[model samples]
Target: MNSRQGALLRALLNAGDYKTAGEYGRELGCSDRTVRSDVKALNAALAREGFHSHVDRQRGAGLRIVVVPDEENRLVRLLGEAEAEMHPRYERLCQEMLALTCHPGPHTADLLARRMFRNKQQIQADLHWWQGVLELSGLSLSLGRYLKVEGPEWTIRGFVMSMLFSFPAPAVRRRILPSLVGSLDPYDRQFLERCIAEMQRDLGFEFSSNAQWQFGVYLCIMVTRIRLGHSLAAWRDAREPGPFFAYLQKRLERHFSMTVSDAEMGLLRDMANCCTWQWSLAAMEAYEPTERARALADAIASALADAFGAPVPDDMRKPLAILLESGLARRGCGLVAPNPNEEAVKYEAMDGACLLSSVLAEVPALVEADLFSPDYARLLLVLFDYLEQVGALRCYRVGLVVNCGIDLALWGAHRIEKLSSRLQVTDVLTENEVAAAAARPGSALAERFDFLVSFEPLDVKFPSVTISPAVSRADIDHIIASVPLWRRGREVRTAWEQEVLPVGPSPEGLFAALHGRLVDEGLVDMPRERFEWLLWTLSIVKDRTLVLAWCGPGVRRTGIRIFRLEEGDGAECGRCTMAAVLVVAPADRGDLTPLTQGFKRLVEDYADTSGAVNDDGFFVCFPDPE
Candidate 1:
């Protein structure tokens, strides 16, 4: 079926009730006749494929899909395959790569182009982009009389496995694989699945659904690649496979009639170790992380400290080390955690994600090895939990000011503290003290407390949430809402600020000028090259101009420098007429939220020095230094 027909079929299948042709037409923005024609064509195609499913239509009630119980799986698979075919470019690229990697013989350009249903020119363009992707994995796309991907067998497998699992759903991957490798024998597939299930039972644990699928798919791919004359050499350095491998090996030989090698068996064992598994409490107690896992954990901890500008408690390392060890094999195999909530975690904790990215960057070993994936969100979530449990997370200090007696004031403070771990009642204050602090914005109280929680409404410069003496749910919600606003609006005390002179249009010129100024002021005390690398690597903050900020080693103090280009100097920084450079000291990294807010405001005010000012904001962040 064509792309539009595929879309129409999907809509019909997903629709809960009979949808009229007119209704479908309106939703798809087509005519009723066109919808009917597509539906008719889809039915014809399904019949031609000998499928027991069809779109049932009634005169007045409209259309619905009818599927027999036995045909349900087959029809669903067909729909999925059709959906995949909708994205020709991506599907073709994946198909081409699979064909090249699985077959040792060079594939002629014409053959690939024909199989992909594309012209030679389009195929060549795809090859060009695919070439760069391979190069990143240290693999080369060999192009000449024919095309092939030249790389180590292990690397090739890892890259392809990474691509396959990238689809997230194991079902989608299962469908795609058969198309690439021709048809898969139902018995062979079931045997491999059974082998994984048996292996899990033998280990006295259960692999997660996705992990089980991973093991099965890995086995299938390994066998296919091996049969196609691509197999890994014996890993002499690694330990030999155990009982489970022997069980799987015997099954593979009996089912597929293929003799499994020691190297292949070892690879399977390593993969099993990395797959996400659930164990009994007794199993957990008996487990200990390897030396390599502990070392990786230490590196991660060091990176976390650098990112947060605070010391990570040594005790936290053990749990992290355990997790690192559990996933070590899968990570090396380029598998990501099968986390359904990954996107949700990222959306909710964006700042935390930014912080984690910066932290993970410090661990060069992880990045170099491609161990850090979208699954980094898991690490960030764990770190946040650990900090909350240990009370080391940066808390929004709240000053409780009440007209009630000290008893009620303390009680209210206690209630507020229970609302969120990120909120801490730093002090119970009377109205007079809050008034006094308002007069002195730089007072010890003003600096200490982020915002105030008052029983009575008070005129104060600091953000305050007026609540009842007995805090209610609504009051709790209000406080929660205000905390974020306070983070974005509060004033920040910087060590210094200055306007930068024109440093030309080149990044080199700008870097040299800023590095010299910072060194002269003793704000940065690092080698010129290192600092220059940092300035570029740091995340940019866009507020009319690209602002780059970093809190780490070279930064001797917290400071911000403003740059305003002359009119017609928009080309100086690529459409930006102004820029702000902020250096945050390690100790003051906790102040990043307010400092960034303050700098944003500062940049907005100074953003229009030139008449040709762009109102857009740009900000980028990099890893914190060691």
Candidate 2:
């Protein structure tokens, strides 16, 4: 149909019940004579479709479509036509409808319908059809019919706004349909849209509907999690590759082929860097210099390229690079040092490099003083160097510093001055104290003096292991069955046995056996401090399955507890005397079946504690130790 005819139909649909020729003419910016002719044409058009329209009027009354067509059929046909048209503007219309349905009020539907070639009845029918389609596609559409109709209103206006901004194409629609359909209401969408818009405006980018939707979905989920007081960062970290990100990646790879240039790669890397930096800053409120930031940037770039299969334009690279370099420099480090004379060039390079150094500093600081090892320090240095090469160092700086109470001058006589400065060591050790400690055999300060850095304490401790309360003996059995060593004659038990059972079977044997099982199953590492902390926690929780005990009248009753490894040393659990309670002795033959059977029972009963119980007790179970 011609645009004029469509416009006329839209006006009619928006007018609702009826309108006199004069009123219709006034609304459409046309004359009464023209309105009357348009009405005649509208009737003729309906007649051709096996439907007829009749206008009726009484004295001092208005004109109305007396015979409304079969609205469902007409709406279905119109939607089909709209779909076939593939007009970009149709997306806007859909968004408006979505918005209207969410907060349906008197003239809201009418206003929306006015944009389409359909009457109010047809508009309502179309809404019903769209809602059904969304449901079929795993979405939900809620109508706001409770409010008065005096003005515009809708139930899910926010959602409509978000959808309009987020779902820009059929492909994006398909990707997000599953997650967003039932989860979002109109209001939620609208609110999310506003958030995304604000974020985009702040970032100085005009995001597409697909981009907006993806971000909105993330924001929505995160906001919900935060509102419920859930672990937001942990949840985000745990989320796997969902359909939206997967699909987007696929599309991006398809667009960018294998022969992508350095410039293109750099651009993609920069964009990813910006996004990662923004997200990290928003979530962490802190920045670090290291391969982690670069890796994140690379991941985003690689995913985008792999999905689109097209090289990014050279034009896009410069701006992104500038942003990455600037952000990194402000944070602390960059790959290349910018020229001093060139304000723009130097700032770009130095920013990334500085950011990197800052971030690298944090790794050592997070390490516990007693548990600090040369290996950890080495790992941090390696990570720092890697970050420098990839240009991720520009994102932020690490603020961690070693706090030695005294200056390095006190150790001058020992020629350890360089060691002190090289390690960022603060001389908490006085000159006389160091000399006196050096004379002692195996002094308390000697062993742990190498790594004495400390981190800011957090209210909640980080989770060392992920355990499920739902874990049962069956799960443990499955794990046990997979161990080759557990199978007779499969492998010889030797010095390695000490790795699992440091003191051998009695109580020590049990502890080692459980420790080996956990490590074999990839539930923990071989760090002694980590093991001690976990053991302490397990002791506090008193998991009958994890604790093995032998008690008799005169014999030293021994208890062996199993625990996961943590980051710090035994210092955290120094108050717990579970280690002292362990008994080491020759392998005894007393009631082995009872010990095994009791453990099995405990494993079966191990249920992860929920809510407040989680804070006070160890509710998680390691995978089955077969």
Candidate 3:
């Protein structure tokens, strides 16, 4: 089946209800006639294949699939296999990347084209894609005569691991990684898988499915690389041996006839920590959060709760805190994992992400952390979005009204509570009350609630939805859809822009210019010497192209300025190209950590890499009105 046909089939199966062809066409980006044609073809194929399912079209209600309950699983499985067969790009990319990394070569585009059965143009496109991927890790792919990835050994290894385990689905990774590794024999791959399973059993805890796959893939790559004489001997470490060092050391030597050094064992230990909770009680004891991590996590959780105007439950708070702790450690090591869902999250939750960045910037403890990267925000965004789905961040305070008897109005209130845990019926309003609220848009009745829902038509200045007194399915769906519109109106704030400044020779000089602006605008009255000292002491250089500095307490505003680092201008400030400078004021608790982190997030969103800034300047944010 083609991708569109497969998508149509999956949608019908997932919905399990009738939907008009027009709806499917709009959702799948096709015409109504095309959707109907695909459905007809898909049904014939399903019947021919002996699947006990067929898409049945209804006159007005639209089309839905009729599936035998027992055959549903098999039908879904077949559909998935067909979809995988249709899209082989991800698998090919994995194979091409592994090929370049494993063999030493000026692996030319011509050679890759022949090996992968693609034209040179296709191979070049692949190379371009790889360039973007490597750039995320601050690495580069040399495209001269042959293709080769160039970077520090540790970074290259991390990149490989990230790529291999990036696809979170266990079944997909298991099917892809082993077959892509050209050097690993079937017996050896199985041995490594068995070894990972044994380790998990011995540790008295099962690795999460994704972790199990990650562990197996990591060992396979490491062993294959080692056999190829690419040992990480130069990657030195003097730390004590890990708890699993002895155990893993014996297994590798016994099975592969190779012994591992302390550095290799240390690497294994770190990987294990990331893949599982702990190996033993001692490890758990040693894994206690540092005081800084705990404080920052608490502050983040509290800020998130405040922004949503809801109390985060202990279950939600605990995971968020743990993520912050690990995120802080990962940032310290300069290891940022790619957020597979970054673009999707950014598109779907733009308002939440912006508000979250603002809240994080105000966090007092976040100043000491380097955890303000896009990957980190994406992770938090995914979590926050998930929490909203599960009703943990449910803050839709709704007002209820009915033209029926008081008893029915009370019943409608309870029905709304059952319709979705997200809606809270804060008040049951009378006709007179509704009229009063309509007259005064800023009345307590209007201000105290988010939206009004009534069984009958009621004129009110507040956002209102009309629903059945019994809350029908259509009404529930309408309420569900309206929530986001209300949320957007409440959460999205207007961001003000400031003037960009020219790149100064040094951060000290930049601060002098900014100090002059703040002084003239009546924003700050600090002496130049003190501002210079803060710039020197409280600044962070990132990607050799961006700098963030704290403009100590009592400043009236927080802003970001893009400084033009013309040609070699950045060298003086330890930057290589056009750089961004963030000047932040202290948060309420007397620390600039929150604002610094927040500004980093803003920079990530607005910094133009595609030559969008022609004036040698990029200024994006303004001071908080408060």
- Best model number under TM-score: 3
Q: What are the per-residue Cα lDDT tens digits for candidate 1 across 457-507?
A: 988767788888768666775675454345533645665465645665445
TM-score, per-candidate, Cα-based: 0.61, 0.19, 0.64
Ordered list by TM-score, greatest first: 3, 1, 2
Q: RMSD to native for every prediction?
A: 11.7, 31.7, 10.6
- Candidate that scores best on lDDT: 1
Native-referenced Cα lDDT, model 3: 0.59
- What are the lDDT figures for the candidates, one per model? 0.64, 0.34, 0.59
What TM-score does prediction 2 earn? Answer: 0.19
Give a tens-digit lDDT track for model 2, residues 1-626: 33334445655664455568786665445677876787677667666666644445545666665646566456334423433133333343454443334322343457656745456666666555555334422345455652121111111222233233322234335433333344456765675566556545544456554445544544443333223232212111222433434443344335322222222223222333323322322323223333443443344334334433543343333333333333442222111111112211111122222222223222332222121122122222223334334433211111112123323223321222232212223344333454455467655442333322122221212111111222233323322222222111122121111111233312334356455654554434445544543342212222122332222211222232334222134221211112212221113212222233333233233321111111111011211111
On TM-score, the stronger of 1 and 3 is 3
Which pairs of residues have clashing backbones in candidate 3? 106-146, 107-147, 361-594, 361-595, 367-593
